[model samples]
Target: MTDIDPSVYANYYWVSSQFYKFRQEFSDFYKSALLYLAYTSVESLSDSFKLDLAFDLSLSACWEITSTTLESCSHPIIKSLLGTKVEWLYYILQAFNNGDLVRYQELCVYNSALRAQPALVENEKKLLEKINILCLMEIIFRTIPLSIIAERTKLSIEDVEHLLMKSLSVHLIEGIIDQVEGTVHVSWVQPRVLGIPQIKSLRDRLDSWLGKVHTALLSIEAETPDLVAT
Candidate 1:
C-alpha cells in the first residue's frame, strides 16, 4: 500500500491527533488497509469502480459520521484487512461492477468531513429549514411577516429572524422585509435546490423536509402577499 498523506484528508486534525492510538495496535498491514479504505472511500464518492467491492463500505462509513467511534466489522482489521475485496460476498453483487468507485470514495471523505463538522451540519439544517418554510408559503413575490411565520411554524421570533438572515445571506431568497421597521432587504433569490431537474437529483439524497420547504416557499409566494406591506 502507498503511504497515506494526512494532509490529503479533511479529518486531518482529529485523525492525525489520534494517529498514535491506532498506530501501534494496528499492524502495518492493517494500517495500509485503513489507508486504502480512506483512499477508496474518497474515490468512490466521485467515480465508479470496476472491481466488485461493495459501495456500502464507503456509504456506511459516511452514514456513521454521527458516531465518533470507528465502525465495528465482523472481521477484525488484522492481516485480512489489507485486501481491497469485500469480506462479505453479498456486497460484491450490490455495489461493484465497473462504476464510479472514485466518486464514491470522494463522497465518503466528504461525508466524513461533513459528519465531523457538527456546526456546519446544524447550520445547513437550519438554512434548509428556513428555505422550506419560506417556500411553503404561497406568497412568492412578497415576504411573509416574521411574526406570522414564526407563530405558524412554532419557531421563536428570534429563531425566525436568524433563519431569515441566514437565508438572505446565502442568497436563497430574493428579497426580505421587516414589516415593523419598514426595512426591505433585496437579496438573490436562488433556492438551494432549484428547478425540477435539480430536485429530481437531490430529492432522494436530501433530508425529507428540505424538499417540502422549497415547495412551501413557492406556495407562500404564490398565495400570500406580505400583508404588512407599507
Candidate 2:
C-alpha cells in the first residue's frame, strides 16, 4: 500500500476531519464507502487520478435495483464525496444503477451550499455572481416571493432581487402565482426542491461557471505589472 499524500491531507484536511466526525451520522452504505475512500492515500496519485477514482468509486458502489428509494446509504456517500457534481452524475448513473433519482437530487441541493466558497479575486467574484444566479433559476417555480432567496442566501433583499432579474433574463427562473393573497387561496409546496436530478444539474452548472471565473482571474493576475508609475 502507498503512503497517503500529505498534500491531499493538507488540501482536504478540514473536510476529511468533518467526514470522520460525521461519518456515523450517515447511513450504513455511505459510511462504508466513504470510510474506504477516505482511508485511501491520495498523495501518490495525480489530481486527475483522484477525481477519476472518486467517480469510479461511486459507480462501483451504486447498484441496479430500481425500487430502492434514494434513502439508500450510497446516495449520501456519493453526495459527500462529489459535492454537487455528483448529483448530476447520480441522475445519469440512476438510469443505469436503478437508484432513486428524486431523493438523491434533494441531497445535492443541501450539498450545493457547501460549494459556495469566498472568491479570491475579481473575476472569480463575477463568476460566483453568475453561478449564484444560475443556482437560483428554479426559483421561478417556487411559490415563495422573490424576497425569500435573499434570506436563504443571507444577502440583502436588493441583491436577491437583482439575482432574480438576472435569472429571469437568462430564462433560468420564471414566476407564477397560483393563489390570490386577498382571495385567500392556499398554495401548495412546489416539488422542485427535492428533485435529485435538478440539484445535480444545478451543481454542475455552478461548478463549471466557477472554474471559468477562477481561470479568468488567474490569467489577469499573470498579466498585471508589479508596480505602476504615479
Candidate 3:
C-alpha cells in the first residue's frame, strides 16, 4: 500500500474548514449526506469548531436534506458508525434518523436535565431541541390537540406552536394551527422513507381507509343503483 499523507492531518483544519465555509456550493442532496458525516466528525475536531459544525444543519433543514438523500446516498461506513457513536452530536443525528417522537423525547429527558454530563449539558439541551424539531412532522395524524403534543415532546405550549410554525415555514408539513381550538390540523406528512415496522403500520392504515371507502361506495350504489350502473 502507498503511504498515507501525514500532511493532511497537519492541515486538518484547512481540510475540514471547507465543509463549513463552502456550504453554499453544495446541493441539498450533498448537504443532507454531509450532515451525518460532519456530525460524526465533531469529537475528532477541536472544541471551538463543534458548534459551527453542528449548526450547519437546522432542524427542518435536516428533514429536507434527509428526504432527498435517504434512499440512494449509500454511505458504507455510516451504518457502522451509527450504532456505537454515542457522543453529543450523534444523539441528535440518531433522533433525526428515526423521526420517532417518543424516542427523541426519551433521549431529551434522559440527557438534557440535571443528569447531563458536565461537559455535555449545554450541547444536550441543543441536541434535544434539534431532535424535537426534526421529528415534529412525522407525529401528526389527522388533528391532534397541541396540548398533548407539548406534554409528550416536553415542550411548553408556546414552544409547540413555534415548532409547528417552523416546520410549516419550511414546507415540511402543510397544516394549520388553530389557536381558538388549540389543535394542529395536519393534512400531510412529507414523503420520506419508512422503516420496516412503519411500513407495516402504514399498510394496515391504508387497508382500513380503503375499507371505509368501500363501505361508502356500497351505500351509494344501494341508494342509486341505476346511476351507478350507468
Candidate 4:
C-alpha cells in the first residue's frame, strides 16, 4: 500500500490529538472550520482506502461536533458539502471496520461522492459493486443457482463466476461454485450486522433447536430403566 504523505498525515494526527480542545481553545466559528477540515479529512481518507484514519476521525470530537452542528447552519453549500455524506461515512467506516458487511451494504448506496473516491474512480466502482453483491451473497447461504445469483446481482453468468472467485480470494465468503450444476454451495457465511428481521430469523432457528432437544430428552426418559426399591 502506498503510504500517506508525511505532512498530510502529521496534520491529521495533530488535529486528532487536539480534538477535545477545539471548543475550549477556539471560538465557535473557528471550531466550525476545524470540524469542516476534519470532515474533509475523513472523505479523503476513505478515497485513499485508509480505513484506520477514517475511523479515528469518526470517533474524534471534531466528527461528533460536525455531525451535530453542520446541518443546522444557514450556509447554502454546507449541507451539500459535508452534511449527509460525512454522517454516512461514519456509518460506512464503522461497519467496514467491524467487518459487518451486511450493515455496510445496508448503509452503502449509490452516491456521487462515493463514486468520486480515487480508488473507486480507478476501478470504475468495482469495489462498491462487489461489496453490494457480497452483502447479498452472505445472506444467501443456501445453495443458489448461478443464474439466480446473476439475476439478483444484475450480473451476467460469467460475471457472477468471476465475482464469486474474487470473493473467495479475499476470504469474504466460503463456498463452492458448481459450474456443471450451475449452483453455489455455501457452507459458511461471515458474521455481519443483523437487523430486526435477521434477529427474528435467528430466534426462530433457536426455538426449533430447543424443541428438538426437548423431544430427545423425552425419548431418553421414556426408555430409562425403572429403579428397584432400596
Top model number, lDDT: 3
Question: What overall lDDT, based on C-alpha atoms, would model 3 receive against the true structure?
Answer: 0.57
lDDT of 2 by residue, 125-208 (tens): 443454344334333333555455554444576676665555445444455422233111112222222355656867998999
Highest TM-score among the candidates is held by which one? 3
**TM-score list, all predictions:** 0.27, 0.28, 0.57, 0.44
**Per-residue alpha-carbon lDDT of candidate 3 for residues 107-198, written as tens digits (9 for 90 to 100):** 65666432444433545555555556556655678899998788767789999998889778877778889999999999976787665666
| lDDT ranking, high to low | 3, 4, 2, 1
- In Å, residue 157's CA in model 3 sits off its true spot by 2.1
Across 136-205, the per-residue lDDT of candidate 4 in tens digits comes to 4534656988886776666689988987887777666788889999988877765554435557878988
Off by over 4 Å in 3: 1-75, 82-94, 105-121, 225-230
TM-score winner between candidates 2 and 3: 3
Whole-model Cα lDDT of every candidate shown, in order: 0.40, 0.44, 0.57, 0.52
lDDT of model number 1: 0.40
What TM-score does candidate 2 get on C-alpha atoms?
0.28
